[model samples]
Target: MAKYLMLKHYRGAPAAVNNVMMDQWTQDEISAHIQYMNDFADRLKEAGEFVDAQALAPEGTWVQYGGEGRPPVTDGPFAETKDLIAGWMVIDVDSYDRALELAGELSAAPGAGGRPIHEWLELRPFMGEAHTITE
Candidate 1:
């Protein structure tokens, strides 16, 4: 099986069909959205396709390598940044087609009004595989 990364972005992606932002969603909507994600993960686990997943906070600090003997330089979580990753899921699947199918399903996670978000998910295959670009 090949490993793939499924990236969910907070910004930079096209607006979802259910464009209402999470902050504007009701508490129950938020809970349902979380439940949908958890259920999806559970399904993947049962299928032996799940590797890992995580959600990220919006607050972040950009750290860069500093010259020897110096601490890493840090920068703002700049509000002007074009994109911010909201979360990611790693999956081991039999084929790229399978990965795409899974991502499409995940993009349909419920959002405002208990409707599908229709969010775009970025999928990237890991290196060292024959099907990967590095090959």
Candidate 2:
């Protein structure tokens, strides 16, 4: 199986996701979202294509390489970048088409109002030395 990366991208500035908003959601709504995600994961597992999946924290830190003898410099939680990645999921699939099909399904994840978020996801194929051919 080949691995593919599904990257999550947000459309606008990072808004504060408040606990109050989450708390205010109807129980059924939350349950439906959970079911959707769970079902998707279960499908992947049943197909034996599941490798690993994870959600990432929003906060990020930046590091810079210094001169040859100097130590690396680190900086924090930069907020200026507009294209900050929200999260990612990695999957092992048989082909590029299969990876794209999975990504399309994940992009339809339910959000507020029981509607699909329709968020954009970047799909990238992982390359490894094992797949290379040397003549």
Candidate 3:
């Protein structure tokens, strides 16, 4: 089986629904949204295709090692960056097509209003030394 990475992307979800912003939703609505996400993850687990998943913290920076006696340089999570990754899921699948299908399903995860986020996901195949070959 080949390993694939399912990357999650969101423009600015947290800002979209802050405490004040999400105040527009009732408690029942929030509960339903949470339930939908739990259901979706459960479905993946039952399918045996869920290898691992994780959500990332938003703060980060880029650091560069200094050459010779120069001081190391550090940059930041640029505010102009539009393609912010929210999370990722790693899965082992038989083919690229299957990986793509899984990514599609993940992108349909429920967001506000029980509607699909339809967020953009980057699907990448992992490459490593081959251990075996078959004819």
Candidate 4:
């Protein structure tokens, strides 16, 4: 099976149908959203196609390596409008179509009113050790 990376972007995509931010949601809504995500992962695990998944904290810092013995350069976590990756899931699937199907399901996760979010997801295939076509 080929591995694919499913990327959920918080920024850089058109706004979701249910665009209200999490901070605006009720506590129960937030809990439900979290539960839905957990269940999704569990379902994938049962199917044996799940490789790995992770959610990133809203806050992040950019750091660049400095020359030897010097301190690294740090940048802001960035504003809400800046590019922010919400999370990712790596799946080992039988075909490209299967990968896309799973991504569509993920994009349908519940939103504020418990309705489908219809969010956008970026899908990419992993290139394991391989030589260029020219080779």
Candidate 5:
């Protein structure tokens, strides 16, 4: 089975059918949305396709290694980071088709008004060995 990374972006993607932001959603709507995500993951786990999943905090820091033993450089809370990744799910599936199907289903998770978000999920396949450069 091939492993895929399913990325849920907060921005930088096509607008969802239900474009209402999560911050504008009601308490019940948020609860329902969370429940849908949990249920989806549970189903995948039962099917043995779920590797791992987690929701990310909006706040993030960009870090880079400094030369030698110097402290790591840090710069964050940047405007460019507004296109933040909301969360991710790792799945092991039989084929690319299956991975696409799963991502489509995940994109249907409940949003505002308890309707399907119809969001766009970025599905990326895990790469194998690196190839040597040829002249």
Candidate 6:
């Protein structure tokens, strides 16, 4: 099986059908959303396809090493940044199509009013370390 990364973006993607900000959701709606996400991950684990999943906090800094003896330089989690990855799920599935199917399911997560969000998710395949005939 191969591992694939399914990325959920907060911005820089097609807008969701229920495009309301999460902060605007009611307490009940937020609870339902969290429940749905937990259920999805549980189902994936039951199917033996789940590798890992995580959500990132909005507040984070971008840092890079300045030099051999210098301190690392840090920059803002700038408001002007175009792309922000909200979360990701790593799945070890049988084929690329299977990865797509799982990503589709995740994209169907509940949004405002307990309806499917129809969000867009980015799917990327992992590179293998094995030597191939082409090499």
TM-score of 3: 0.72
lDDT of 4: 0.89
Give the TM-score of each candidate. Answer: 0.90, 0.74, 0.72, 0.85, 0.87, 0.91
- Residue pairs with colliding backbones in model 5 are none
Which of the two candidates, 1 or 5, achieves a greater lDDT against the reference? 1
Query: How high is the CA lDDT of each candidate model?
Result: 0.94, 0.76, 0.73, 0.89, 0.92, 0.91
- RMSD, every candidate, angstroms: 3.0, 4.6, 4.6, 2.7, 3.7, 1.7
Name model 4 segments beyond 4 Å from true.
Answer: 131-135
lDDT of 4 by residue, 78-113 (tens): 685567888899999999999999999998888888
Clash number for every model?
A: 0, 0, 0, 0, 0, 0
Q: Per-residue CA lDDT of candidate 1, range 26-74, in tens?
A: 9999999999999999999999999999999999999999999999999
State candidate 6's TM-score: 0.91
Q: On residues 1-135, what C-alpha lDDT tens digit does candidate 3 reach at each position?
A: 788998766554334222233357668767876676667678777878777888888777878998989999999879887767878888888788999998887767555566665666788888957668755
Specify the poorest-scoring 10-residue window by lDDT in model 6: 126-135
Q: Indicate whether candidate 2 or candidate 6 has the larger lDDT.
A: 6
Q: Indicate the worst ten consecutive residues by lDDT in candidate 4.
A: 76-85
> Candidate 3, which segments miss by more than 4 Å at Cα?
12-30, 69-71, 131-135
Q: Rank the candidates by TM-score, best first.
A: 6, 1, 5, 4, 2, 3
Residue-by-residue lDDT tens digits, candidate 2, 12-62: 434423212445667887888779988988998998888777776778778
Output the lDDT of residue 53, model 1: 99
